[model samples]
Target: MPPTSPALRIEVRGVDATEPAVAPALRFLLRLEADAPIRALTLTTQIRIDATGRGYDEQARERLAELFGPPAAWGRNLSSLLWTQTVTHVPAFTGATTAPVTVPCTYDFDVAAAKYLHGLPDGEVPLRFLFTGTLFYAEEGRLQAAHLPWDTESAFRMPVEVWKELMDRHFPRTAWIRLERDTFDRLYAHRVRHTLLGWDDAVRSLLETSGG
Candidate 1:
């Protein structure tokens, strides 16, 4: 009879935002265990935001209209949103092991994931991680390879504060906006014509004119 493959399990132990030493990133601690020795692991993780996992206050719902349409249509619109895909290697281990998943985040409002995360007022962000990859192991003194089970997954409720802290460290009391080349040229021209001391003043002036 052929050697049976070992069943693998994964769990999200904890999360933390990197500081100046490791700026602009969030790291997740994953604990993995298996019945047999794992020679090597190449893990592909798909991170998703479960919009329906948490309740949103009235104010938060209003702020999230752009992403989910309106509160009334939430039942249909509030599905999981793919945040990012990351691949990390796990070193050889026996029985159990812990690994770190470093996810680089962006504060650009143009991105849907960024917008959704920024719109949240408070509370934990529900995250679902789907994993897939190849697993290497040794059976009866012979090396072997097997496909990771399709149902391998993990759920984590990451605190919003972690993300907020990361952004604050990278951009204190500021935000990022990406503009088209033409739009930027027009804004620059207006600033020069108005003798605006800085980009902030030029933007404030435009906002005032538009009653924003």
Candidate 2:
């Protein structure tokens, strides 16, 4: 009789702010299980926000209007949002092992993921993880490699506070936004022309002038 191929399973246990809190990032704890000993693993994960999996508050719905249109149309417009893709190398393990999947975060409002996250109020952020990779193992004293199943996936509801805390640690009270070079040049000229002490003053002056 022939030996059966090994199978793998993955689960997300929890999430936390990265250690040292030096930058904006989050770490997802993953439990990896296999029927047979795994010599090595090259894992690729695609993290997505299941936008429709959870409910949103009125404020959140209003804020997210730019992304999903009016709340009335959200029934059809809301869909999964691709957050990020990360790759990690898992060390040798016999039956089960734990790994950390670190995801870097940005505060730039120009980024859709950031905007979506910021729009949310207090609640868990529905997340989906899609995984595909290659695994290496010993078969009869010979090195063997196998491709992971295409259906490997997991779901997790990450707290919005975790992301907010991470950003606060790195950026304090400041937020970031990107602008076109031409626009920046014009803003800079306006700032200089008005002898504004800071960018905030220049922007506020413009907003007031425009009746914003």
Candidate 3:
């Protein structure tokens, strides 16, 4: 069901919802996937629906509770501080369904790959976060009714500092990146993105690289 009122749109702001707010680092990944600014997401329809007294907020709270529990797997305590090694900004070009969205993470990944290209210790390279999410626009504001997929994953044994530089240069709009405490060391490969890569040639590259 689309939003009953254009103003009564639904939005899921990616955040650190676990234990004292999800880790800022993980929250950063979610923020990158959001359609609007992190803060605006929660109050998307607040002023518009406030006058109607529809209890939209309450309903949203419940819906979010259910969605976040499964959709978002990263708990709190994840954060990042940018430290650059060698960074470069390049245009992100990708698309799916006739929508052209930039694949900034690809640039970040390629940039981060420099270290490995140069041959650096696995641990010396910083962790890489390529969290990707898509927001569907169906009719009006019924975000809940739309089907948007979320994919979060990382590359490990990487030099941490180098990854930050890559993100800073290619994907600054994204927020902090930090090491997961448990260190699930093996390359925790997930189809994560800083933004939704349209299902096009650009996305094809990812699939090809992943052997999809």
* Clash count of each predicted structure: 0, 0, 19
Task: Give residue 8's error in model 1 in angstroms.
Answer: 0.8
Where model 3 places Cα greater than 4 Å from the true spot, the runs are 1-134, 138-147, 150-157, 160-212
Kindly provide the TM-score of model 2 when superposed on the true structure, using C-alpha atoms. 0.95
What is the C-alpha lDDT profile of model 3 across 64-168, one tens digit per residue? 333223223313311232222221121222121111112122332233232222222222423333322333333333333222223333333333344455444
> TM-score of each candidate?
0.95, 0.95, 0.17
Q: lDDT by residue for model 1 over 72-103, one digit each (tens)?
A: 99988988898999999999999999999989
The order of the candidates by lDDT, greatest first, is 2, 1, 3
Off by over 4 Å in 1: 19-23
Order of candidates by TM-score, top first? 1, 2, 3
Candidate that would win on TM-score:
1
Instruction: List per-candidate RMSD values in Å.
Output: 1.3, 1.4, 22.9
Which digits, one per residue and each the tens of the lDDT, describe model 2 over residues 11-62? 9999998887666789999999999999999999999999989998899999
Q: Select the stronger candidate by lDDT from 2 and 3.
A: 2
